[model samples]
Target chain A: MPTGSVQHFLHGSISSNDTLQALLHLLRGLCEDAARGSIPFLDQEISYTIQLATGNSSMSLRARRSLMYEGYPWLLTYYGHTDSADSSRLVAVRTCVQAGTSDELPKFLSCIGFKKDFELVSKGHVFKKGDMRVIISKFYNPVKDPTHPDGYQPLANEYLVEMSAVSPKFCEVLAREMHTFAEQLKPLVYFEKFIPESL
Target chain B: MVVVMLISWESPEGMSPGHANEKLQKKIEILGGKILGKWDVDCEVYSSLNGIVGLSDTQTTQPANLGGATAPQQAIYVLHNSNYSLSTFAILEDNTVLIADSSFDQFMPHMKVFYKKGQRSDAKGNRYELNEFIIKTGVATFGGSQQKILLLEITYLLSDYVHESIGIIRELAKLLLDNSFPGIETPITVREDKKFSPSDLLLQYKALFSHVKKPSTVK
Candidate 1:
């Protein structure tokens, strides 16, 4: 599937693993419908970000390789500077390309004058309703081999719940719809846009 | 899928790149090759951020930089060929090549540190089709108009077998260049193997750039 440039997303986090399990069960029930049935998604991916830091300005590119995807495994996304992290529904110009299973992306980025900044493993479950995707994932720092099951250290004690949609252009209706979806998951986990710099 | 071979021609100093390109196109036409369309390959150079950002070795103790900094910081190259519309990112220092979507070029501006050194876009050329073979003649220019190099690319579109088409391509080059064949330089990746793919063309282009710009000495 072709990814859209305008990415609309809202993020929330649950502290306890018990709450996450309960939320997953609740999500399975919420997303259940007779026509499409209940769709539970398992997402296991490793994300690597490459940065080009000029003395004054710096830019970064991210590549996410899915362990679950056997055929088309890599998704390279470029987040433009126009993206606003402060908005209620965080909007960003995220251009994404689905690449083949070549582990040469990091090599390629390095070839293009970008240095590997960080690497993290994200394992999660996904719930879909229409175009909206609700992802609950945890991030881990790879201690040894990133691809190995036992080769990681948890970054935090919380599971991040992200509701997002990719659109061709900024659509108010899509952002509102995502906000509404976030509201439905409220009390279980409060979805808010947390700025990375502040954290 | 098509396989391509790139040959560099040293056009006479006085002849402008445009005139040289026209001369090659005429020769291809005389050989019963029909002009298919125009094709071009452009390259943009970007420098690394480490030296520019003033990050000392002690402060840059990131795991990603461990052992990666031994090689001197080399400028990055983002190359685009109009025919494939795919972006080929290469660093000639280590012979690393990555093929990505053309839209990847848009992300360059967002990277503050890797400043654009200069760009060469005048590597424009024409594409010709002769029988089952495809011929492309491009003038690689500097500063938009000063043609520096002439490149001849021959593609065998029928199959991926590189050896099978070499004889026919040689025969066509004999006609096209009037038996004065420019040296055919195969990229390191394809030098040993006989199989071919679209990415091979990008690698060939990278080889062309490497010949022109020594990656180690590049600023």
Candidate 2:
């Protein structure tokens, strides 16, 4: 759940210039491929949307051993800001795939952000100010919780505390682990990179 | 009772579990079959890149089964007959896949139901079927996001050492049985998308069937 604030830009220190270049590189290549096949991949731009306070206060707990993150689904967040007090400067990088492939990219992007690359076996946590917060573990699926006290409900609802001030810390850790992660993120900065030669 | 089975699925990060599970649960729905529950655990890594999902023998003296293995934590095991284990199943990314714990397999093997290849059958039909003495270890990362496992669209086979179905499913026959586990009349039928329904579970178990099938993909 994102705060829906522009603070996302200021928090993660994400760069729009670099990410945009990369996305252009990728989109251009995709277009070329589509053209070769006589299939125009219209709507080649990335899309952004926010999961605001929908009043969907649902949550599930992961095993202490298997918990991949602490604060989660309930809490929405914005990533990397252009400046502190980011009034309205945050970006969400998402590429469209055929309906069949839309579900695939989420996992791939997560793998790109985290270093371990392993599906989070452990739902980790970080306690701050005596309040337990979501730990930053990448590739973790928050939906696998079967032991919901609510007794078997939707896999969605990750009962996590929403916090922007500290949540960015998780992103920073992710960025630190992957020097180019911030650049590689599918955000404004990532959109700028030139697609690799392979394209 | 561990189900000692595997579940595989497609991935979409941050996609709400409710959303994905709703989709998959509807897909799992049956004439009467339903999802009882689901759980997520770490994905298991096997030496084989294929989705075989077998663990290497940690010890040599004992069987390849995790409990029997007697080596350091780093040990690997050989695969037993993977047949009779689910035979057919699905994995959706971030979905709550309720895998029976090892405890469930003991009772499940004795569980039997009627099923057919092309037509719906009754309890008295010739297509009577049931999973062998099976157990689940726990929810595992089955057919996971490729980045985590690094191997997808590869070959896989059930282990032979599973011991429950080994005798009945001779190499050739077993392969035939599991591989051909009847694909539900429809793959996208909804089972337990929103909540676990007991009737759905009983109906599915009773309706599901396994057959003589050997997996050629494992090697």
Candidate 3:
């Protein structure tokens, strides 16, 4: 895994289901090759967050487990602190690394002293244009059978809209391009690169 | 795959590491083992400022928002082996082993005040193939201390069960090291009804490394 790679992203939220549908429709029209299609993806992951027993600093251990994929290999992603991009960049920059892990990851983590924090499910559609990826997902509490639509509780009434591009070198141009693409979503949704004050 | 790790505690009455390696290589080659390639295993010691809370402690604690101070610093050995699928093994102080994807290194810097205290790498490790088995030998440079320890790791490719293959591994290790390998007998207690796991191999490594770190008794 290359340690120099970074993720440049912007976040926005759709207030309601109706607004989410409107925003999705708007994106379908705005995205390249609208008539082609979009890939629907379901993300069922359990995030094990371990905090230093003495401080507020913490790290999250998350692996993606999707029922749609055969055998459901756990593709682990280790996330570093999400740095708030400066005013000039207008995108949040975070360092993340992805690696292939086995199903014993949870048990292994427990042995090494990490406690399970929470598990959430996210289902949404993904749109891509060149190097850009736009994801619109809604969060839900874990369900017994993720393949089934019922027996799940929604964590939020809003849809999270994220636009991101991963690059090994510092990419100010890519961030600018993402900002311009986000601007096209206009009145339907407004994306910002702010990290909350509480974080 | 199952792995058994052993350390050559003494190199036949004052032989240097290089001389010992040459002797072992000749022995392995004479046994009809073919040199496969070179391997590298880097071990790093990292101590967490606010260490991860133990699971048992969390279960037994009172149900209050317990003050987070007074946690002991946790030290662990992180091993990266070139042969595995980028597997990163963490051997905690308590002999608890955790295996994670190699990319887990990216998250280490984010964990509260986690920093590397010492590091050692065996870049000249050798991988050899014998009939129905694989062998890896390396010399670990004890971090900052400049001490060298001989490492021998054996894998039984034909059998997945450790219990079924323990006798073969022990015999092979003894023959290759000329009976100077003391760690050979340590892994026997773990050979039971359970199948071999990579973590078990890592625990053996921790024991070997710590043994080399012990202070001398002569005053």
Tens-place lDDT digits, model 1, residues B1-219: 656777766655687756877888898898799988998887766555455333232222222111233433555566777876645444344555666666556555555445445445447778998888889998776553443777778887776766666667667766776634654534556643556866666766655664563311111
Give the local distance difference test score of model 2.
Answer: 0.23
Off by over 4 Å in 1: A1-6, A15-61, A71-73, A78-102, A110-118, A140-157, A167-171, B11-20, B49-72, B86-92, B158-164, B210-219
CA deviation > 4 Å runs, candidate 2? A1-89, A92-199, B1-48, B51-54, B57-219
Between which residue pairs do clashes occur in model 1? A53-B113, A54-B113, A57-B112, A57-B113, A58-B112, A59-B111, A59-B112
- Per the 3 Å backbone cut-off, how many clashing residue pairs does candidate 2 have? 96
For DockQ, the strongest prediction is 3
Q: How does model 2 score by TM-score?
A: 0.17
lDDT of 2 by residue, B1-219 (tens): 211222222234665433543433332232232333322222121111111111122111211212222321221111111222331111112221223222222221111111001211111101111233222111111231211211011011243222332233333222332332221221112232333222222222221211102211121
Fnat of every candidate, listed in order: 0.21, 0.00, 0.46
Candidate 1 chain B worst ten-residue window by lDDT: B57-66
TM-score of 3: 0.77
Model 1: how far residue A80 lies from native, Å:
6.5
lDDT per residue (tens digit) for residues A5-76 in model 1: 666667789999789878987887777463453444333444444443334445555677665565544556
Write the residue-wise lDDT of candidate 3 on A101-129 in tens digits: 65666765664456777888887889887
lDDT of 2 at A100: 15
* DockQ pick, better of 1 and 3: 3
iRMSD values, candidates in order: 6.3, 21.0, 4.3
Candidate 3 regions exceeding 4 Å error are A1-4, A15-36, A44-64, A67-85, A97-119, A143-149, B2-7, B50-73, B94-96, B112-116, B119-124, B181-183, B186-191, B214-219
